[model samples]
Target chain A: MQKNQSIEIGALLLEIGALLMSAGANTNRIRLTMRRIAKSYGYKAEYLITHRAIMLTLQNPNGDLAFNQVKQTYAQVPNFMMVSGISRLSWRIVDENLSVETVWQEIERLKLLPKYPRLIILATVALACAAFCRLGGGNFTEMLIVFLASFSGLFIKQELGKKKVNPYFGVFLASFITTMICGVIGIWYPFQHDNMAFVTSVLYLIPGIPLINSISDIMDGNSLNGIIRALNGVVISFAIASGLLIAILIFNAV
Target chain B: MDWIDFFEKWIWFGVAAIGFAILFNVPKRTLIPIFIMAALGGSVKLVLLHWGDSLVLGTLLGAVLIGFLSIYAAHFKHSPPFVFAIPAVIPMVPGSYAYYTMKGIIKLSNNSNTTDFVPLLNDTITNGFKTLFILMAIAIGVFAPMLLTRRDSAKQIKMPLLKQDKK
Candidate 1:
């Protein structure tokens, strides 16, 4: 019985650590939370976090290794609701002292929690991009153009994302599509700010979360992870610029 | 800038933040607070800009205020500070600077416009530096509040989150 519980606790710690990392929590918090959760169940846990991986070890009271794990968490996608749920979960486990079975079930429940419906996401994202254009000094008509441009771009992105397309390619395609749409509109009436609508329309794909996380990780002293995330942001930025540049070149040529 | 025009932009900033909330799939229960926080951050920046501060300084102040407030919201909402804070600052990100940098680079690469090379070079350099500094200011500003608050966990009842989970 003792040995089985020990194995269960080790697996649970690693699972939780990977989940937190994937959901976009910073490295410091992941380690801190993992330690707290392990301590509650009478194990001492140490963790090492990198941009692409989480490594942790569990030690029994006798100073023997309980278990060790190195988990690779995939690139992050913004899911604030999931992240918050996951963050609260460690504390809940400690506060209520949930058993291994209950905790396992809870983890499954968190993973299966439904994301936002597609229609709402589409509409709000379009509106949000439109609002960004308005904030960029776009008038009402230009905002509408931006709305349609983002609407189509986000639509293409969601469809492609469902097929498991690489995110960089997804961003590239979406920027290409949105800029093309904006390009068509500009020919009718030149944009006041020289591609203002075209630019703001694709602002939704700015990889804001990674940029924010990169800085937070640095501030929390995880400089390596921070630099890694910052590099990821740069790659995504390049994807977007290339896509938009292609569309602009095509418009100029035509 | 006119006060009425200034106030109108914050409303749009709120509208824009709604998109971020949607993109992140923020739970409906916390959506309104996120919008208000985003709006406040954007408006604060604008107000600072109107007062003749540099773009970096204005963004810093706005992000700092929003960062502190988002933590308070997270406490009341019982979620992580980041969940609220990340979405709230989306409006203030320097999207235009990035776009201009791309344009300038593309222009420079043509290698045929010597007459405009100086201006193109200036545009790229200024926009690139502007984007970097503004982003750094935002990052540091948002974090300052969190760092300052961590030292005072003795008032646990007042600041329940200061005690643990370092990030």
Candidate 2:
């Protein structure tokens, strides 16, 4: 293959890696899928994947020609559709001997995959948090409070994200809003399971994917990336805690 | 728990999973299987907890069930297991323990007297450890099968041979 062709393949592989990483895939999946796709194109690919960037090296079978490139990844978003789409696309490339151009087109198509509407996402997530409240032994009234609290909290978070606010601050602000709503209602209502609502209201902010992905990354021998992801989870959790604390202090002051 | 209570818990588990799956933007076709798998996992944990099992142990078993079932579900749905497994396990997060841990820490920082400080410290430690261990249990349990299998079920693609150049 020509040097330009190899460069194209390397760029495509890096794009795939960055997409998978940002889509909340474990490092192992990113490594395996990228390698598999490169092998299908008659090249050997090696990747140095970090939380914020992916560096890929593609070489011909004889090891004489090599192409290297680094791509900065987008912000981490837990879109499983993109993760699964790219995984399936890698397999199609291997199975059908898809050309580099074809694979690139497929990647472009996957990028355009439609997401769930924002309003639907907001309602479902709020309902989920309310279910969490119920599981924590909350009464119906507490569940209703949690539902409203989380809905508004998630709305604020989404709006903050759209405005390019720092994500950790977005989480902190969202949780603060959620806790304030729950706490104020609890103080007035004095229900049996008010504590349950308070506990479950901010749960929609739990960094579930990052926490799990960190462990899986560690278990898969990518400790560096795992540690980075784990730290990311810790910071988000700390932001949440800080938000709750401030809300509790305000309640105390009142 | 009675049969009615058990079913109620199961339905809530399913609903929670569906909510999270939507939040994560999983493919629409895979939602039902995710719901079933999540409900089963949550039920396993609930039954174990009711049977006097430790919370960490019950969570581990539940996550294991979700992890293994997710493998099958991934094969059936042609999607990654994480799609099914992650949302399914969200219902089991130790949210209350985490909340209490934070609350304890804040109180601990505020109290100046040794008498209040000691118990606050203890409560913080206990809740903090519980939160850490439960999260570890869930993560380890949900990914154990995939780790042991050493291959992602959904991405087990065959490798093609490198073409040989003619002399």
Candidate 3:
């Protein structure tokens, strides 16, 4: 009886960690996708994780829940990558009623694909072009510059993924490259309203920390956190603004 | 933009929906219903905006009405509320407007020589506040029911209903 209770408790902890990792997902889009994946594995209430925050859905008839560290450990590994297939692995553990530690060991035995950098680059470039077209009134030249900036960032993330560079530095380089492109546009075409469009479109890549944090705050019933997330969003907006303004100022000075 | 022109340009909503659908890997089959619902809501908003009425009131009404519609649609389709609710409302997302406001603020700062910062500041503040109000309006409409009813209804409500109630 005690053993089964332990397993249920372990699974609950795993769910909570997944909730936190998923709460700030790139957009609710990722969360939605995860729910679909979970559904394919016959896991209902996938969206419940977002609300319940923690739960024990799996229980053993013998009164022995499969509690062990392995299940939780396996769950965490996929946090950094696409989790579609992770649900499948999780289902295996659930169906077998295996110990959490055993599930982790089994997950290690399964072959997993490494994160592909080219896909990230392609997605970034495509989205950048789309955003530019949307915001800049289809100004071809502005679209070209935004594409180049996004491309440079993609290449940097690739290098970081390969362990040839640090990820934070990579993201900063990407940000600088993007900012520089926007700065040049501002200097060359000071009168056009399209520059605003160009900058706003690129802001999509700015991590959406505000929305995620806000939702997380609300889900946790923490009003302070929600307010903080909203403020954070504004601050980040200003920070991006400051970065762009400072760049243009330096350019004008030169 | 006029009514017909509104729908024509409202292609942006479709684009947003498709973009979100692809990013999230939602089933292609589910896209049409979501798109149509967003279009309906978006058209109402565009109409209200054209009438020179309060955009806040328009947004609030649009969100609440759309929220209710999404819940109904989810029931009819036998899908989760988050499924229909999230994508169906993409047209209402404040993404574009928020982008414009932030960009406006930055451009104002760039014009350091201009003494007209007051007007620019007004526009920025107005937009910033408007975006917040719009999102909160949507959340109030959507989350209020979900919160009031209690959390984790999928575990509690979905199964028994699915078993006993056949639509």
Candidate 4:
């Protein structure tokens, strides 16, 4: 392959790596998928993947560096569809010997795919948190309280995201709002297991993907990336806890 | 547990998984499989808990089952396993434990008297450790299959130029 062709492939690989990283894929999966795609195109791929960026180098058949590029990854959004879609695309490239242009087109299509409607997401998440309350021995009233709290919390989070607020701050605000709602309701209603509502209300904000990915990365020997992800999870959890603390302090004063 | 209670818990577990799956925007086709896997995992954990097993042990076993099921479902649906596995295990996350741990820490800091310090510190430590261990269990359990089956090393690819240059 020509040097220019190799350069294009390197760029594509970097793009894929960036997309996967932003979609909350672990470092192992991103590295494996990129390497597979590079191998399919008759080049060896080397990468330094971090929380904020991916630096990729493509080596030609002679073991010479054909291309090197670095791309910045945005904040992770946990889009499993994008992660799965790109993983499948890598397999298709190897199995079908797909052209670079076809691969590029497919990536674009995956990016453009529509997400689930926001209202459905909100309802289901609220219901899920309510179910969580039930599992924790909450009564029906507590479930209802949790449902409303999580729904409103999630709505605030979504709106904050649209406004391009920092994600940690958004989580903090969401947790604060959810806990306040639950706490105030508990004070008025005086029901059994009211604490269950407080416990489950802000749960919709738990950074599950990041925490899981952090551990997987660490176990897979991507210690640097793993630590970064772990720190990210810690900060988000702290944001959530801090929000809850403030709400508790207010309740204590009351 | 009674049959009615078991079924209620199972169904709720599935709903919770579906909620998170949608939140993550997993492919529509994978949602049903995700629901089943998550519900089954939750049932396993619940059953174990009812039998007097530790929460960490129950979570680890349940997550392992989910991890294995996720690999199969991913194969059938042609998606990455994490897409299914992560959401399936979300319901089991120790969110309440973490919350309690945090609350305990705050209370400890705000306490003005030394009389209650021991119990407060004890409560904080227990909750903090529970949160950490349960999280570790979940991560390891869900990752076991992939770690065992897949090699992370890159495959070697031969190019025509290499042969031509050799000739």
Per-residue lDDT tens digits of candidate 3, residues A1-254?
65554454445445433533443332233344434333333343222233223332433334433333422122111122223234344444455655556655544443354433456435644453454355335555555555565555445554665775543454445455565766665566552454543454344334333553365456646655467556755564555555544554566522
Candidate 1 lDDT tens digits, A1-254: 86777889888877877777777777777877788788889888888888777787888888888788788876566777777786678778878898989889988998888888888898888998898888888898899999999999999998998899998999999999999999998889778766778779998898887788888788778899999989988898889988888998998831
| Candidate numbers sorted by TM-score from highest down | 2, 4, 1, 3
Relative to the unseen true structure, what is the Cα RMSD of model 1?
3.0
- Tell me the tens digit of each residue's lDDT in model 4 across A1-254: 59779978988998999999999888988888998899998998888998888898888989998998889997778898998899888878988999999999999999999999999999999999998998888888889999999999999999999999999999999999999998888788865863768888888999898889889999999999888888988899989988988897888721
Question: Candidate 2, residues A1-254: lDDT per residue as tens digits?
Answer: 48888888888888888989888999988998888889988898877999998887778988865898889998888899998898888878977888888888888888898999999999999999999988989988999999999999999999999999999999999999998998888778875853778778899999999999999999989999999999999999999988987887887731
| Pairs of residues clashing in candidate 1 | none
Model 1 DockQ class: medium
**Candidate 4 CAPRI assessment class:** medium
All candidates: TM-score:
0.93, 0.94, 0.61, 0.93
Q: Give every collision pair in model 3.
A: A4-A64, A4-A65, A7-A66, A7-A67, A71-A100
Candidate 4, B126-166: lDDT as tens digits? 99999999999999999978666664421222222232222
Residue B120, model 1: Cα distance from true site in angstroms: 2.7
Query: What is the C-alpha local distance difference test score of each model?
Result: 0.82, 0.87, 0.49, 0.87
**How many Å off is the CA of B62 in candidate 2?**
0.1
TM-score of chain B of each: 0.85, 0.87, 0.74, 0.87
DockQ-based ranking: 1, 2, 4, 3
Query: Across all candidates, what is each one's fraction of true contacts kept?
Result: 0.77, 0.80, 0.02, 0.77
Residue A177 in candidate 2 has what lDDT? 96
